[model samples]
Each structure stands twice: as structure tokens, then as C-alpha cells.
Target: MEWFILFIVGVVGGVIGSLMGLGGGVIVVPALLYLSAYGLIGDISPQLAVGTSLLAVIATGLSSTLAYYKKGNVDIKSGLLFFIGSGPGGVFGSWLNGFLDAETFTLYFGIFIILVSLLLFLQNRLTPVDLPKDNRVMMTYVDAKGIEHQYGYHLPIAVIISFVVGCTSGLFGIGGGALMVPAMLLLFRFPPHIAVATSMFMILLSSTTSSLTHLYLGNIEWILALLLVPGAWFGAKMGAAINTRLKPVTVVLLLRIFLLIFGLRLIIDGLL
Candidate 1:
């Protein structure tokens, strides 16, 4: 039953996270921790859960990035650029993750959840940053409609933000897109489709490094990661298929509420 539960979690997290470009760690982490707390899974620590969730995130990122790339939504160059910062940040965060016990990890994770939940919710609101063009690295993209769009960011600012988000990703076992997407939308002025697709690409790049660090730390649950991979992979494909047919506003709202409650519960558990 526990294994089955985890498989299902992979599917749910992968599908929703693919759409959101978060790589499913937000869902997977909380689910793993909750199951462990309830004895539905055996002796799973926060580090293990995070490591496992990050592994699943890789599967989701790979699946989603491929699908988005074929659709011409992914900004491969930008993704690589951000990875310059995020990759190193992920390694640092992974090293830091090894120092925390269950209680402390849980409390910090709970706070992270709340912050991520709020960020995801706010992303739906379209706010323009309109940065100075001179200070920005401008990008030109031609959408499916053949309409050319201009977007980009200040190099230093983008790198710094990606680094911080990447650190959070490795520390919490996420894809780093929870914060990245919003920053892309609001700060970097990326188009929605472009932001999400590029975020997946960056996640794909960064998660690899982060997972390697986790492996070195022996924080990953290899067996569970294997189980999660298949479901996460397939679910990401499903989500990408739905991208053209759906808008995620309603879904995100519900996700925010669910995460809010779950995050608070984890906080309480940590305090206890």
C-alpha cells in the first residue's frame, strides 16, 4: 500500500508540477513526509524524502523539457545561462542539507512550503517589471503565432536569483521552479509559456547536479526513487499534452490551499 501510495504521488506531483514547471518536488516532499509520519512508509527521514523527491523531479523535468522543446516553448540558451548559477548553488544547498535533523528540516521545509505556495498563487497575476533595456540581456522569441516577443533580464540579477532558488531546491529537494517561475514572470519579464518551459529546462540541468550531491551524501532512497521515476515520467508527458488545452489557475488555487494546510501541519509537527 505504501509503495502504491508513493507511485500515485509521483503521478499527481509529476502531472501538476510539469504544468507548473516546478518539477513536482512541492507535492512529493510533503507527501513523503506525511506518509512517513503516519508509518505508511518506513523510517523515512526528511533528507531521504527530499532526496527521493528531487530524483522524481528529474524525471519530470526530463519529460517536460523534451515535450516543451519540441513545441518550441523552451528557451534553451536562457536555461543554460541560469544553470550557470543554479548548478553551483544546488551543490552548496545539498551539502547544507546533511546537517539538519528531522525536526529542523521539517520546520524549515514547512516555511518553504508556505513561501512557495504564496509565490505560485501570485504568479497568476500579470505584473510587468519593465526593466531598463540597457541593463538587460534582451531575448527575442517568435511564438507559434509568428509574433515576435522581447524578453530578458539583468544578468547579475538573474544569476543571483537563480542561485538562491537553486540553493533552496537542493536544500528542500525541489526543482527550484516554484520561485523561479514567478521571478521569470515578474522580474525577468518572460512570457508565460516561455517562462514555464525554460524553467523545466533549467530544472533538468540543476536537478542532475543536486541529485548527484544527494547520492554522495547517501540521502537518496534509491528504491523509492526508482519507483517514482516511471510514474513521474509518464505523468509529465500527460501534463505536457494538456498544456495547450488547459489553464492552471483553478488548479493552482486548490493546490495553494492544500499546501497551506499541509505546511502548517508540518510546522506544528516540527514544533512538537
Candidate 2:
């Protein structure tokens, strides 16, 4: 029954997360919390919940990255550059998690969630012309459809942000896609679809590194993570298919709503 519950959560989380470029931790964490409270997973703690969620994010990232890559949305150069910093930061964050309390972790997560929410809201309101693109570091890619796109400038910023987000993911068991997608869109001026696809590529590397580190630190639940992967895989493929048919505004609004709900749920969980 517990595994069944996890499978369902994983599918739903993956679908929503793939659509919005999230790590699915927002959904996974809550599911873990409920199951643990009911003794569904014996003696499971919040830390385990976070760690397991991170591990699941690793799977989701791998699946989504492959799908996006097939569709020609990944920016390999930029993704590799960001991973250089994020990979190490993830290890560091996992190490630090061993010393932190649940309240401390929750507080940090709450603050980040709120900040991400606000940033997305504000960005949506801004006109494209009002948002200036940084052209410092550039990368080019050809999509599956044979469309060529170039992204230039803000390479340094992308690296810096990826490191920060990776650290958080390592610590909190998230994929940091919330921040990554926005960074790609707002900082690098990527189209929403491209931003999401690229974010998946970046998160795959970052989350895998972090998950492996966390697993070594005794934070991962392999059984649970394995159970979730199948559902996540199915959902990701479905979501990727949907991405091609949806309007940008519609996708953004849907993502915003999901984030808001997740943020609110987390906030309530923290307060209680």
C-alpha cells in the first residue's frame, strides 16, 4: 500500500513537475510526511523524506533530460558549465544536512519557496523589452525540429545560480528547477519551453550528483526511490508531449498555480 501511494504521488508530481520544470520534491515531500505519520514507512523521519525525495528527483531528471534531449532542447555547453559548480555544491549541501535540524531545513525551504514565487510573479508581469538579456557568454543548439537557437551572455550568473540551487537540492532533496527555469528565462532570456527543457538537463546532472552523495550519507531510501521512478518516467513523457501543444502563457499560469499551492502547503506544514 505504501509503495502504491508513492507510485501515485510520483506520477502526479512528475507530470506537474515536468510541465513546470520542478523537481517534484514539493509533491514527494508531502506524500512522505503523510505516510510517515501513518507509520506506512516504519520510523521514517522528515530528513529521510527529504533525502528520498531528492533521490526520486534524480530519476525524474534523468528521464526528463532524455526526453528533452531527444526533442533537441538541451544546451549542452551551458548545462555542462553549470554542472561544474553545482556538482560539488550538491555534495557540500548533503554533508551539511547531516548537521541540521528539521526546523532549520524547513525555514530555509520556506524562504526559498516564497522568493521563487515572488520572482516568477514579477517576471510574468514584465514586458520582454523591459527585461534586458545579458550577452556575456553564449551557447547555441539545434532543436529536434531543426531550429537553431543561440543563447548568449550571463554565463557567469547561470553558473552562480546553479551552484546555489544545487546546494539547496542537496540539502533539501529538491531539484532546484524552480530557480533554474526562472534563471534561464529571466537571466538568459530563454523562451519558456526552452527554459524548462534546459532546466531539466541541468537538474539531471545536479540532482544525480547530490543524490549519490546523499545515498552515501545514509539519507536515501532506495526501495522508495525505485518505486517512484516508473511513475515519474511515464508522467515525464506525457508532459513532454503536452509541452508541444500548450501556449506559453497557459503553461506559465499552470506552473504558477502549482508552485503557489506547493508553497502554501509547505508553509502550513512549517507553521504547524
Candidate 3:
């Protein structure tokens, strides 16, 4: 029953996460924590849940990224730069996670979720800042339907933001896509599809590194991860297909609603 539950959760998480470029950690982490609290997982620690989520994110990110890449939605150069900055930060965050107790971790995770929710809610209301015309790292991308998008961004700012996103991902076992996608959209003026696709690529790198660090620290539950991967894989492909058909405003609204609900739930759980 527990394994079945994990699989179902993975399916749901992967679908929503892939659509929004999130690595499904927001869904997986909270769900696992709830199962553990209810004695379904036999006293599993929150840290273990988080670690397993990160491991599962590897599958989710890889599957979604491949789909996006084939559709030409991914921005490889930006994603690579983000990955480079995030790598060390991921390692450090994993190491830090080891020192936190379950209660403290839960509390902080709740706070983090709420903060992210607020950011998502506010993102659509904010005015986007365009990159200067003369920027050296301008990007022109053609999507699956042969639609072209042109944008530019300050590389240093992106790198710095990615480093912070990596740390958050490692700490919470999230893919950091929720944060990264919004930053790419608002700060870098990236098209919504491109931002989501690129975020998945970056999550692939960040989650892998973070998961390995958690593995070294003995935080992961391999059986749980095994159960989650298959569902996540199938769901990711479905979600990627759905993404290509959805409007950007619709996607953002869905993400905002999910974040708000999940974030509030986490906060309530922590307090109680």
C-alpha cells in the first residue's frame, strides 16, 4: 500500500512539476513527510524523505528535459551556465541538511514553501525588465513549431541567482525550477516555454549533484526512490506534451494555485 501510494504521488508530482519546470520536489517532499507522520513509512525521517525526493527528481528532470529538448524549447547555453554556478551550492546545501533535526527541517521547509508561494503569486503582477540590445549573450531560439524567440540577459546575475536556487534545492530536495523559471521570466525576459524548458535542464544537473551528496550522507531510501521513478517517468512525458498546448498565462495560474495550496499545507503541518 505504501509503495502504491508513493507511485501515485509520483505520478501527480511529475505531471504538475514537468508542466511548470519544477522537479516535483514540492509535491514529493510534503507527501512523503505526511506519510511518515502518519506511520505509513515506519518512522522515516523528514531528511530521508527530502533525500529520496531529490533522487526521484533525477528521473523527473531527465525525462522532462529530453522532451523539451526535442521540442527545441530548451536554452542549453543558459542552462549550462546556471548548472555551473549551482553545482557547488548544491553540495554545500546537502551537507548543511545533514546537521538539521527533523523538527527544525520541517519548520524551515514550511517557511520556504510559503515564501516560494508568495513569489509565484506576485510574479505575474510584476513588470518584466528587458535586457539591453547590445548584450553580448543574446539568444535566439526556434521552438518545435518553428516559432522564433529572441532574448538577452546579464550572465552574472543569472549565475548568482542560480547559485541561490541550487542551495534551496539541496536544502529542500526541490529541483529549484519553481524559483528558476520565475527568475528567468521576470529578470531575463525569457519566453515562458523557454524558461520552463531551460529550468528542467538546470534541475537535471542540480538534483543529480544534490542527490549524490545526500546518498553519501546516508539520507536516501533506495526502495522508495525505485517505486517513485517509474511513475514520474511516464507522467513527465505526458506533462511535456500537455505543456506545448497550454498558454503561458494558464500555466502560471496553475503553478500559482499549486504553490499556494501546498505551501499553506506545509505551514499548517509545521505548526501543528
* Tens-digit lDDT track of model 1 for 1-272: 77888889999888887888888898898888888878887789878988889999999999999999899999988999999899999999998998999999998888888887777667667577777778678999998889898888988888999998789889998889988989998888888889989998999888889989999888898888888888899889888877756987777788899888888988988899
Put the candidates in TM-score order, highest first. 1, 3, 2
Q: Flag regions of model 1 displaced more than 4 Å.
A: none
- Candidate 1, backbone clash total: 0
Scored by lDDT, model 2 comes in at: 0.74
User: Best TM-score goes to which candidate?
Assistant: 1
Superposition error at 270 for model 2 (Å): 3.3
Worst 10 residues of 2 by lDDT: 126-135
Q: Which ten residues in a row have the lowest lDDT in candidate 3?
A: 247-256
Q: Comparing candidate 2 with candidate 3, which one achieves the higher lDDT? A: 3
The Cα error of candidate 3 at residue 70, in Å, is: 1.1
- Shift in Å, residue 66, candidate 3: 0.9
Residue pairs in clash, model 2: 135-153, 136-153, 137-153
Write down the TM-score for model 2: 0.86
Give the per-residue lDDT digits (tens) of candidate 3, residues 185-234.
Answer: 88888998889889989999999999989998899998888988888887
Query: In order, what lDDT does every prediction score?
Result: 0.87, 0.74, 0.84
